[model samples]
Target: MLDYAKVIVTGSPISKSNFKLFNMHGRAILPYNSGKYHDRYAIYEQEIAFCARLQNPNIVLSQSLIAVLKVFYKSEKRHPDTNNITKSIFDGIEKSGLIVNDAQITRLIIEEFYDSKNPRFELELFGESRYNMKYEICTKKILDEPKEYGPPSNKKNSYLSKKSTFANTKEAAEDSKIHCSICNKVINAENSVTANNGKMRICKDCIKKLF
Candidate 1:
């Protein structure tokens, strides 16, 4: 089973010799056939290509593993080989002792992909207290007008600051008291700074000096 996971990580075309080892498991493992880029390969190249688009390996494996598991689970009732294939996969996962094992991948798959009730944890990495306002502004600018900044002037650290990124966007109006006209920095509920306009919005503290 763990070996099947390797089908995605190898980043190469599948060969007959290596694929033969798993072929004995039969068609239950057929979805993986799509993983192959070569003739007679079962794994779909599109599946792997989608994973490759992600910059993060954990994200890639997490998606691919989940997709493969779902195909097996859904087909189990219709396919006689399904039960045996699923069992073999679990068994292989246990035997391989891979640090990046299937269980963790399974959790990610269920929580992120399979389980509708599961709460998302991706944003949890940034706790509420640490949620970055300034970074959000910078990211928005990059996404909206990405062409403005070419491949980073400094390739090493390409992250742009909000102030620097949105320095030129015109203010909304003089009377708007609440918002930072330049980047929508809001005035606080408690200590609101009145902009040239009288409208209340986000506070200056929300705006960071970084960008």
Candidate 2:
């Protein structure tokens, strides 16, 4: 069973959003990559591919995976939003052929730290095979138990039905008053705007503050 695979790419990390440029041709506008960013990304991809291959030689994972990224920055001045750096790392993992696609990653964890001496990022990929085994074991244990596991009893079902009915009646009674989605404060209908075609109710005070 494969537990996890880790690869570390050593370099000053770059943000995918910061190095884009736009070009105009006639009346159309198009986005292009900066030369410096292109060169740096090429190097990053190569390093990631090399490290991943060394760790998991001749195998590519296709199972549902969890990815953990630990990023170290050179200094506080160079720190950027952690999300901005994920695109490059995910793209690199795809280009490396370590996984069939980055979309296979169902869970992601990210941590940022300052490491002036080693400004780099570490990627850890965890396969779900182990978790699946544990889940199967748990299910078998539950099945072996003496107690019966099935639907609710008639009395319990009646209680749940009554609770649901009460909730609906309460909602109908409060229909005249709108609750602000942000602050969750009850306000009169006139003071609230039905945004997104009544999907969202936001009070005027909140709208002014947010906008």
| Per-residue lDDT over 1-211 for candidate 2, one digit per residue giving the tens place of the 0 to 100 score | 5567787888777876654444464443213344554455556656777777776776688888988899999986547668888887887777778888989888888888889999999888888866432212234534554744433454788878888999999989887666898899988888888878889989999999988
In order of listing, the candidates' clash counts read 27, 0
Best by TM-score: 2
At residue 144, candidate 1 shows an lDDT of 55
Model 2, which residues run further than 4 Å from truth? 1-3, 23-38, 132-211
Instruction: Please provide, for model 1 over 1-211, each residue's C-alpha lDDT reduced to its tens digit, 9 standing for 90 to 100.
Output: 1212332222222222323333564532334445453334334234333333332334322222332333212221222232233333333333333224435433222111222233111111111232232312233534453334333345534444545445434343434445554466555457545545855343555445423
Off by over 4 Å in 1: 1-39, 42-46, 49-69, 72-80, 84-99, 103-211
Q: Who wins the lDDT comparison?
A: 2
- Write down the RMSD of all candidates, one decimal each: 20.2, 19.7
Error of 1 at 165 (Å): 81
